[model samples]
Target: MNLIFIDSIWFTFMLLPFLIFIARIADVTLDTLRIVFITKGNKIIAPILGFFQILIWLVAITRIMKDLDNITYYLAYAGGFATGNYIGLILEEKFALGIQMIRIVTQKDASSLISNLYEKGLHSTSVEAKSNQGKVHVIYLIVQRKMIQNIISLTNQYNPNAFYSIEDIRSVDVQSERINTKQKKYRHVGSEK
Candidate 1:
């Protein structure tokens, strides 16, 4: 304590950079998730994640500023940021936490697909729209994010050559509140008869 200064050569060159690297990784991962939560309209969790993210960020930046001449710190910070983004995306995909809408545009009939969806307790609506090619059935449905693969499989089974797009459902009304709770007991389980 009396002889060696707190910013010793070993600490500045080795330990400090390592600590900064780890801190940056944690901060950026939390930041990525925080942004996702915000986009998903999660009011409570985003701020909590933001709080921890910034706290770790401040600690890391303070270290970076103290050793501005060191290039190792910069490389570590950048590498950590990139790695954190990759990990965060993987985690987000694994979580799959939201509702989505799948729209299938097919020139063929959608009755079979609709029936299959109904059997699976999923609701679907079909509209006969005139496309440039011919009449198309624009079949659409609200689906939980986890069931997206199943929906794609069913569409492939029913409409072999169908064009489909999936979109995030940002909000739902009181009528369809079941998307957020009690998915199994959703009162309106099937589309219009």
Candidate 2:
């Protein structure tokens, strides 16, 4: 007697929007986590994220397929995608993974800070550049997330009025070379003997 195959409870259709919304949240969250894992070079977690991401995507698509005639289902599907992107970005910001290059510029020369950073086993490069005020010294360093605060503090201590910015670095190799300064320290992997 019933043309619609979905039985049990017709009222269950009412919950479709809520379910879709949650699915969207999960899908986006999965994507964000995947990116974070990849950026951090987490081989194990990346695969796990990919598995969950595709799984949620399939469930969302299946719901849409079953209720092709329902307009609310369509809305939920679209809304989920949009919300997922926003959620993914928010999650990425919360978890700052990956190598980052920090460029610190100060109105005054920060030779002391540079020396301190070198002693701490960090690589750096410095150059003279002109800012809105006058000539300033700019120091660049590529470091991991955990060392970000320490670098920032050194920047502040060296030059309070310095302008600085941090950005993600896609790749770097152990053999990479840097310009030499008196404070620079070279690391030896093993004994020369």
Best by lDDT: 1
> Over the stretch 1-193, how does candidate 1's per-residue lDDT look in tens digits?
6347556888777877888888888988899999989998999999999999999999988889886999989988998888889888888888887788889999998888777777767767789999999999998887667778767877887877999999998776637732432255332323333
**lDDT of model 2 at residue 167?**
86
Model 2 C-alpha lDDT per residue in residues 1-193, reported as the tens digit of each score: 4545436345445576669878977887788789778876788998998999889989988988877887877787788878888888877766656667889988776788777776666779889888788888888987665467767776777787778899877666746655222122432222121
RMSD of 2: 7.7
Give residue 43's lDDT in candidate 1 (0 to 100): 99
TM, every model: 0.84, 0.66
Candidate 1 Cα lDDT to native? 0.81
What clash count goes with each model?
0, 0
- Measured over all alpha carbons after superposition, the RMSD of each candidate to the real structure, in angstroms, is 4.5, 7.7
After superposition, candidate 1 runs with Cα above 4 Å error: 1-11, 174-193
Task: Quickly count the clashes in candidate 1.
Answer: 0
What's model 2's TM-score?
0.66
